[model samples]
Target: MPVTEIESESQFTELTKNDATKLIVLYFHTPWAQPCQTMNQIFKTVADSKASDNSISFLSINADELSEISELFEVSAVPYIILIRNSVILKELSGADPKEFINSLNQFSSSSSTSTSHNGPTPLATATATKPQTTSQPEEESEDAVQERLKKLTTAAPIMLFMKGSPSSPQCGFSRQLVAILREHQVRFGFFDILKDDSVRQGLKKFSDWPTFPQLYVNGEFQGGLDIVKESIEEDDQFFEKALQAAA
Candidate 1:
């Protein structure tokens, strides 16, 4: 099918949630971004090549026009691509590499037809599964730099959540529940989408010595994951208050 331009969130939802679609290639771009100009053509070419496949669909979203959808995925940059199959994130790619874009679509389109599970795709190759590009790795961040960055991030707000997706659209059940709990308690928190930044995603595991996500940090200290946070609230109704007060 030809690439459909997503005009609104409702339209996007209707098209993406259709049962017939086995693979959805979402291109998030902004007209002002220089990189997006190049990626626009590349995306169209790739989409055109796959036009014969009825089970696969391509969508182009203006990050600014459909702000809610962009924010749902925590899209911080333009010229981004997200592959989805059955509501699960298959892949996320950033930047304007034509070869990488085409190659990824080809890989996932073939796999989407055979994959029966509703779960996200398995790691493409260990640590690089969430890596932004298929090739052309970014310079490694020094350990000290990573540590310093994590330190600032943890304290970026009084309450911080490092989760799989944004608060509005949690990618996993655990993350959704944690976001609900915070909202129930009327807590204001900042969140970092681990899916967007592999550096923070991997570094945070060691930084807090927590191997899992939906991690809650209170006043720059490790609070816990979903279960632990629930337990903390159960133990003390004043848990969030105490944490914020301590920072104050």
Candidate 2:
């Protein structure tokens, strides 16, 4: 079995973000890190064997050489393997335990094999909740008509996100960051692009009585936008820690 070296950040992106099927097992660390060396051997051995069988795609990256890539994966510690398919990360693991790593793959395979077919991976929002309208966009429709349409979209799911843009292409940094946070947590969500609906756009402003886009609602409960979410993360680092723990 041969090991494919993930040299540049673009190559790394091509490995995980694009291939999707090519499971990335990045080994992020500096040369001086003692535990990193041990983990690299463990990963290399597993990846070499697994790659031959086409069971998994194996690649290693030195965190020092690709700081940006590490940042994308949010690698806080060394000797870690982040398993990803497409843009969705299946899991992450730390340390140098061959048996546990193999067990993880087995479990993942078992679950994925039985998993129901989905159009694509799920998103973070599960519902929608908000309704507001105005007369300025007369060319479109009446405020009441627009409000009714918005109400339908808001209630499309039990949890929904009304923001600057949709899931694939966010219109603002806050929305983009917000989307990333939800995906990293593996939360399935729905989003309404206010940019597409002027009525809903103004309607949400008055409906929530809160002036802002990128607003999040879980189970129909309003969760504030980016700054608030970041503040929440800052208050409890455990926010990311817990999600990473589950990934591991």
Candidate 3:
């Protein structure tokens, strides 16, 4: 079964991605909800019926436990189904209707099959998807200025991840892996790319008392570089895991 149970944001990160090739169903819920359990059973039954199909995958994520995914998906109510393909939502529903669920699933399945018939991979239609957080304004906050501003913002969160790129579009392989790992763990970190800011690029070494570009900070404390983070992952230390838990 592609779906088991997602307890942490790390598990959620491993499932969702910017890649447009995967089909994902995110089921968000809470433990104190009796109706949530009933809805989960219904979802499990539906998943069991369609286990043979390899086109899509299922995820059962606890809303209370996985706050990052919950907040990202915005599941204030329990028992919701978010059908996402290529990191975009195609269908969204929150109810106990079996017939409608099956119908929607079938429709997506058919559409997916037809689209996958040709080409190297499923072409993700560009939709000007990302909304710039703040309107692009000209001022001292140029990419250079933003870098300096981002360094201050880095300490804004308990965990700060300063690298060559942001979490989503990493410029280097090390930054990419670190992004994946941080997102997987739902670290709630602030990211800065040295490539964008020359000041922070050179200033961060002295700021965080670290010598590397892809540096990590916990509780506003300097953690280490990519190799250190990778080693933390292997040792099961998950340095930011508890920090996120406490903050959440």
The TM-scores of all predictions, comma-separated, are 0.49, 0.43, 0.46
Stretches of candidate 1 above 4 Å error?
113-248
For model 2, the stretches where C-alpha displacement exceeds 4 angstroms are 109-248
Choose 1 or 3, whichever is better by TM-score. Answer: 1
- Evaluate residue 39 in candidate 1 and report its C-alpha lDDT on the 0 to 100 scale: 89
Candidate 1 residue 212 C-alpha distance from true site, Å: 38
**lDDT by residue for model 3 over 1-248, one digit each (tens)?**
74669866555667676345657777877778777877877788888877887767888887655544554554556677777776657777776666777787777866753232112211112111121121233534455665555445565556666777444345688887787786566545555556755656666777667777688766556778888888877887655676555545
lDDT of 2 by residue, 1-248 (tens): 44666777667656666556554455666677798777767767766666555646677777655543554555546776665555566767767666777787666644434232323223223222222221234566776886676666655554467877555545698887887887766555566667766767788777666798888655444557778877877887555445334433
Alpha-carbon shift of residue 208 in model 2 (angstroms): 42
Better of 2 and 3 by lDDT: 3
Per-residue alpha-carbon lDDT of model 1 for 1-248, expressed as tens digits? 49999987679879987764578888999889999998898899888887888878899998865644665676768798888887777778889988877887778877755453334333221111121111222579888887988888887777888888666456899998998898788776777778777888899999999999989888888988999999989999899999778766
Please, what is the whole-model Cα lDDT of each candidate in the order they appear? 0.77, 0.61, 0.63
Per-residue error for 69 in candidate 3, Å, reads 0.5
Q: Which ten residues in a row have the lowest lDDT in candidate 2?
A: 126-135
To one decimal, what is the Cα RMSD in angstroms of model 3 from the true structure?
Answer: 16.9
- Give the Cα-based TM-score of candidate 3 against the true structure: 0.46
Please report the candidate that would top lDDT against the real structure. 1
